[model samples]
Target chain A: MSVFITAFRAFGSQVNIWLDTATPAADGAPVLRQVPGWLADIEAALSRFRPDSELSRLNRRPREWADASETMLSSLDAALRAARITGGRVTPLVLRALVAAGYDRSFEEVARAGEAGDHATPVPASRWEAIQLDRAAGRVWLPDAIDLGGTAKGWAAQQIAQRLAAHGPALVDLGGDIVAQGKPWTVHVFDPFQPETPFAVVALHDRAIATSGTDYRRWGADRHHIIDPHTGAPARTDVVSATVIHPDAVLAEALAKAVVLQGSIAGLDWLAQHERAAGLVFDRIGRVLATENFQAYLTQTQTHTQKGA
Target chain B: MKMTSTKRFAVRTALVTSTTLATVIGAQALASIDEAARAQPIPAPTIAPADPVLQPTTATGQPVSAAVPNVVILRHAGEVSAPAINVEPQAPARPSASVVSGSAAPILPPNPVQIAPPAPVVQQVAAQPAPVTRSSR
Candidate 1:
């Protein structure tokens, strides 16, 4: 069987699509024509870019008992778990702040929300308690515009992976919120400052990797979208970038945020609790602080890019 | 009654066929390792690249290391993907390194050797070797 691989950069990053199919399809075929029609299904289910997406509907719904799909509901649950685990360091509640900070519109709109005076503080991070879900009725109510952008990406990646389960060997990188299934694939981690070079090239076969850093997409030299729920402002710490790996992408995404906000020791402690979660953190210093399990990931995907990425 | 030569030939063919099937089945087990090796994301770099070195440990809790030099992500070997771009490795010591607290920090008297501020040398923390494959097993 011939291998199928497709990659495209969207949502401000890159995504790699791979598969060892029974036979390869034409490259020009519309994304819809692909064997795994599941991609479209997922794009429809969670795309924040598409105007009619489920998330968009929820975002626009003006108070008529709106229904959330199983995907969103499941994600909410995961976000809640991560929030509890990290003691609220990570949360979906940063939505109000995100919008006020200028991400209220499309990602581009937010990008235009010029990095300004210290971000506007909102009522202490939207409390998850304010949101209500009627499990039996499949309904959700957000007292405030409690945003889920934090956990949605991770949720979407997981959903996409589940949709492609029957497919053979695959990797999905939704703007760096990556999730892989089955056989492993090579991934290169780069130094954000030196986009031209790669720091390490790792072989990841089955786990989800989500990186949280303040490089290009930041509000200012000191601000980025990765908001700190506790302070209602940009998160500050010595760790410049944090990559979290876990069987659960939702936790990984949320945890990455939590760790970057909490700093090193506490972040490692949270990372240690999950048997499947380990991480690598890079500081202002040119050193590598790896969790007990991070070294193994580097060994399997042993290729390193010549330049610092 | 004497058995004919053709009858003996039929028995031999049956034995041969049975043996061939066994060989194929046994070979399947041996191929699993190759399958695993091929299925894995093997290191592609012929020469190890520069490691993400850490700056010396500091008072505030910050990471001291820059990049993990050896980590092998594997099946069932924990999480493998990263959250964002790895930070550029700076030639400074990791503020949170063990050398600062793990009895590795060279002990100094209350007022000890203070060489006129060693001209801005990039102090980096060394990386330990632990490849990803070791943990998967």
Candidate 2:
């Protein structure tokens, strides 16, 4: 099998697409090149910071039925499902809250700004039920400013992997929100600060693993992305970072966010109830706490290393 | 009483033969059981010889004794001519459901009642960005 790997910038992060194809490299080059355009299209449809993006346009018009693209509709659907599943812990209507938290610009710009104090009040997000989607008409009515930022990356990863499945087996890793199809892929999860040493490595067999952390995209010293919809403030839970392995990347992303937002104990309990999902939570002190059956995903090499250690 | 003396004697002989055969069969069965028991390695059981009365099962339906020593073996007729000893069918063993000690099934703790969080207090206000003036995309 030949491996065609491509990496570029999109979604304000490094996007990597690895295609294991039977076709020759010459033949596979064109097929591999098409993914960047596809990712760009998805980004245009879903990005919250882009003023001309479809999501931004929809956010501008409240209480009006606006025609949405197929991509936007699907992303909206995934975001709504995420909100419902997390019981409002994760929601689509968190854009205003996110902006109020000093995340009004791209994460790069936010990080560069490094402003310490919160300029806006921390108000709770609008309930997810306020946003309505007319699937048959391909129109969405947003009564509130709904942001697809949380589920957008994982949903895009899922969509990209699905699109590439026909050509060959693919692994789409969008800023650690991954989707693997056709065969199992070994994913090593590392800290955002320490990207060199992986704390946990899991093998994905037609599965996905998403990591949500408070270590990245910070404006203030303590503040980071992944805001809690409940209080509209940065999650003050014990979990510093959480990685969830699930069948669907979108759900995995949601699960990861929920894990960090709810804290380690409640998060582990919640993950335990989901038979298909397993999680690893890093505490503020850098201790690792994993859910049941999470050890099953540890690579044999890592297992041997732990034994020797 | 109505038949001849010959008939009566035949009936007595038949009764004696049946009794003798049943006794022989019972002896053979007991011998076989003893031989089988000797062939197996048996653990020495500590018997404290309680009241010679049988105790009923507990409220939770657990057996008190590990071994049943007073088993009544019933012999069936019509097998007198057969050389092999007839063994009676034993009752199926009942699984114990012990509440006091080691129970087969695990005991789960009572589920805690979940109290839902208070509803979010939504602040009603006019649109902040003041609806973008341009037409919808």
Candidate 3:
């Protein structure tokens, strides 16, 4: 197994990179650099931290049509499509809620800010649908400032995996959002109370898995970083964690948020009926739950699995 | 005395036929599944929803979902059979209630007390598999 792990902080969160392949490369420095460059683009397109970034700029110039890159436009397009698919289950309004809840900075910064974190409060769930994108013209027009946090980082990791397609079998994990070109890779789902305890171990054979958990990203015990569009606050659910797996990283990433929003009981049932994505949900009781397909996917011998159309 | 002879003959004939059929089917279809389950095999990480087009699955009555073990769900066929897995199709569904340990409150529309499916959680094995040592010729 050719394995590599790299770490850095981008998208305002510490990132861990792991890759596995059929043949090991002599050195992996060049392979690793691609990740940072990828992060930089995602930040430019999605980061709310930089006032000049796409999201920030859109928040400020909510009316003007700004020229957008194909990536930015496409990402926004996908998010809209996902929103439609999930029935407004997830919305970009979460960005406003995140900032208002003292998450103006990266997660690490929020964790460090303590009481001072509550300084610059804003309105909740700033409604992402109001912020529209023009795919044909590669431009974006916003009606108000909304947080794209619900989808951006996870989407970025997926985009990176797509660009790095030439690198053979690899796995890129942006925080908990992951996309693997292949497996021999072991990913442990974190335990909220004692994160040291891994709730599950996934063996991926060229697939993507993204997890959304309030564990490390919590404000208090009840408050988490994952905002629910419905309530415009952190998602409140019985699910300790939800991990989504599919060949499409974007789909897996988006579904992770939906699962988290749905909570364990409802989310688990939802997964049971919806087989397009394989899922795992952990309850506070420390029980494991997965959809039928997700269970079956785990049974196939490692190496290859078919996904999407 | 007449009843005793008939009972004896019936028992002998039934045993011979059932054993012959048992050998022909080799433990009986679907029988080994429950038997192999005694050890509680390591739970699979991903779950597949019942796809009418791709996998064969029984109608799932529950709203929230959990992964079912090894039972292949075929959507189009509306049938489930043993298969290698990975290549199978899945029905898209939502996660369960109260999944994580010390997690946020339940997110379901109605906080119902229901059993979450098993495919999501990866359980520890009761016994570890044996190691293989290589031999050089």
Best by TM-score: 2
- Which digits, one per residue and each the tens of the lDDT, describe model 1 over residues A1-309? 444545443333334455444444533223313423454565565555577878667767634567887766776677677778777877767766765554555544444444333445544586665566676788777655455666766777677676556655556666567777787666666543333334555667778887775443454445566678766766776555677877787777777777778765556655766688877665444334556566666632322222223
Ranking of candidates on lDDT, top first: 2, 3, 1
Q: TM-score of model 3 relative to the true fold?
A: 0.63
As for TM-score, the candidate ahead, 1 or 3, is 3
> Which RMSD values do the candidates have, in order?
22.4, 24.1, 19.2
For each candidate, what TM-score against the reference? 0.61, 0.67, 0.63
Instruction: Give each candidate's fraction of reference contacts reproduced.
Output: 0.00, 0.00, 0.04
For every prediction, compared with the true complex, DockQ reads 0.01, 0.01, 0.03
- Stretches off by above 4 angstroms in model 1 are A9-12, A22-65, A110-119, A300-309, B1-137
Off by over 4 Å in 3: A1-4, A19-27, A119-130, A182-184, A299-309, B1-137
TM-score of chain A of each: 0.81, 0.94, 0.84
CA-lDDT, candidates in order: 0.54, 0.65, 0.56
State the DockQ, from 0 to 1, for candidate 2.
0.01
- lDDT score at residue B78, model 3, on the 0-100 scale: 21
Fnat for model 3?
Answer: 0.04
